[model samples]
Target: MSALAIILVGLLLCLAGALSVRLAVLAAGFGVAWTLAVAFDADTGTTLLISLGGAVLAFVLTLLTARLLFFVGGLCVGAVIGAKLFVLVQGGGADLLLLLVMVPAVALTSGLLARRFERPFLVWATAFGGAALVLSGVGRLWADAAGELWRPGTTAGVVVVIVVWVVLAAVGYSVQRRRRD
Candidate 1:
């Protein structure tokens, strides 16, 4: 049920994120709330209820301070990219210190760019984020049904996931680009 909900939300973000920034912001809040709630070992119902409350608070705050939130989102996206680059470059000896130093620099740059190019950046951000959610939700559903992990189990699973993410993001980006005013 949760997996299904995730897929639906992911699709909404992917296909219509740029058309509705408010919804996208709400979804981001909800997604973050859900992730944080799940990290605690609590009753599922109670956790979900609390998560929903948190999401609501986040949505309201984001609505009040949209520009600040977009800058934060840019920082997050840049930090992720920077960390990934660090890992890939360092490989077996990925240094935490270097990553810590690198992430902030990249994040700062990205935040500035996001502020300058809000709509286009949001379109890209939503596309990438949504694609990730769709893939993760599908993988979770598949694992639950089959009692196995698909991405890690397959020999080329990682590559396939990356390829799929890129394709899905591209499709979403293209569609949203056309649709956005």
Candidate 2:
């Protein structure tokens, strides 16, 4: 398959995986709804309508599968990664590797953390997002240390990510502590 086909398939599976997580339903919903905006394979109106329909279905499915959300999330993440693997084998692109590795890894780790620390999925999600931001910033720094290390955008992103994660972690700890009350 072509690279565009591969990316499209990957994105679809990612939408499915994201929809599997109740907490991520909003993002997934919007993402699916924006399909037309990104893909030009069909009439804009028709594509947008289909996207909206899919978003509604995904949102309902996510809510109904809330109890099994993590397992579903893992499955979806795995599927997306698998799709990426297929793309890579087809000589898709270097970015496929990042998606394959990051998606499943983040899903597994986040699922585990959320399970171990229930009632704080929001904080955990925030921390995970922050960690990702920090990692991305670090990668940029590695790529061009001289240009971005002290750049306002880079510094701000890194600092916000770290501070957010730290604050979330502290909040998680506090919530756990107070639960004994």
Scored by lDDT, the top model is 1
TM-scores, in order shown? 0.55, 0.34
Candidate 1 local lDDT, 88-148, one digit each (tens):
3443555788887887887787777777787688788667667766776787787866312
Q: For candidate 2, report its TM-score.
A: 0.34
Give the alpha carbon lDDT tens digit for every residue of 57-174 in model 2.
Answer: 7878866765566544444433433332333233324475666676677567655644455335533343333333333344344546422322224445445544543554355344
Q: Which ten residues in a row have the lowest lDDT in candidate 2?
A: 11-20
The C-alpha local distance difference test score for the whole of candidate 2 amounts to 0.46
Model 1 poorest ten-residue lDDT run: 146-155
Model 2: runs farther than 4 Å from truth? 1-50, 71-113, 116-119, 143-181
Which has the greatest TM-score? 1
TM-score of 1: 0.55
